[model samples]
Target: MSTLIAIAITTGILSGLWGWVAVSLGLLSWAGFLGCTTYFASPTDGLKGIGLSIATNLSGVFWAMVIIKLSSMVSLEIIGYVITAIVAFFMCAQAKKNWLNFIPGTFIGSCATFASNGNWQLVIPSLILGVVFAYAMKTSGLWLKEKLEADKLVEVRKN
Candidate 1:
């Protein structure tokens, strides 16, 4: 539980910081950076999870700026993305899921920002892709867990 909370706080802070930077630089929002960073920060264990947590949280701060760039809706974007990400992270962590948890927020944040920019072209695609990615991650994580368990069982039998 503590770990999950840490992840949410970390992701949110990163998101906000990135948002601020994006807004300052006149970038359309930090969605691209957010996505890239999330993928990069995927946790393999305690050490990697710590680093990824820091990176992911800070990336979310950038989403605030993304909202600003897309619709001049800084507050909405911040609230929407931050709340969703925090909640999703906690829930998914408790459920022991991985990147699957972040998909909804990413999709919503991306689509919302793009939709505000009058770029309807990207909204649907982003949402669809997010869902697909989430599904993939969920399945993969479960598969890996199963394999690990099976390996452990084999070792125990041999012992």
Candidate 2:
């Protein structure tokens, strides 16, 4: 169980990174791909967010209904695809220049996850984990920048 949890956490982090990259590239289709990848990669709380975003952004409630019905017959995993498609649709609608503008998507995704799951425990943990992962990425990026700067200075001194 512990190992499974660890795997889920790691998968979530990777998914976030994928999502960040996809958004940065400003590719709506790839964003959907990333969202789907993230959902399928981790059997974690994040799926709840993916689920809601997809549901909200889909063309119509009819499509959403079909997805749910088909998902029940085929497998629960299909739910992730349905949700991802919806998110992609919404992202396409927005089409902003700055894809890495994480605030809107993050807030919307987190809220959607909570609404969809209606499980306080899962939602709470997901929120905490998502926030942590975001901050960790920021901090790591900063560290990388400092390390590169230090390396450059050392090379200059040697020269």
The parts of candidate 2 lying over 4 Å away from their true place are 1-110
Prediction 1 TM-score vs. true: 0.34
**lDDT per residue as tens, model 1, 59-153:** 33334344444444445656767655665454335323353334434444444444446343343333223333333343445555666678889
Q: Against the hidden reference, what TM-scores do the models get?
A: 0.34, 0.34
What local lDDT score does residue 140 receive in model 1, on the 0 to 100 scale? 46
What do the candidate models score in CA lDDT, each in turn? Answer: 0.43, 0.43
**Which residue pairs clash within candidate 2?**
48-113, 49-113
Indicate the residue-level lDDT of 50 in model 2: 46
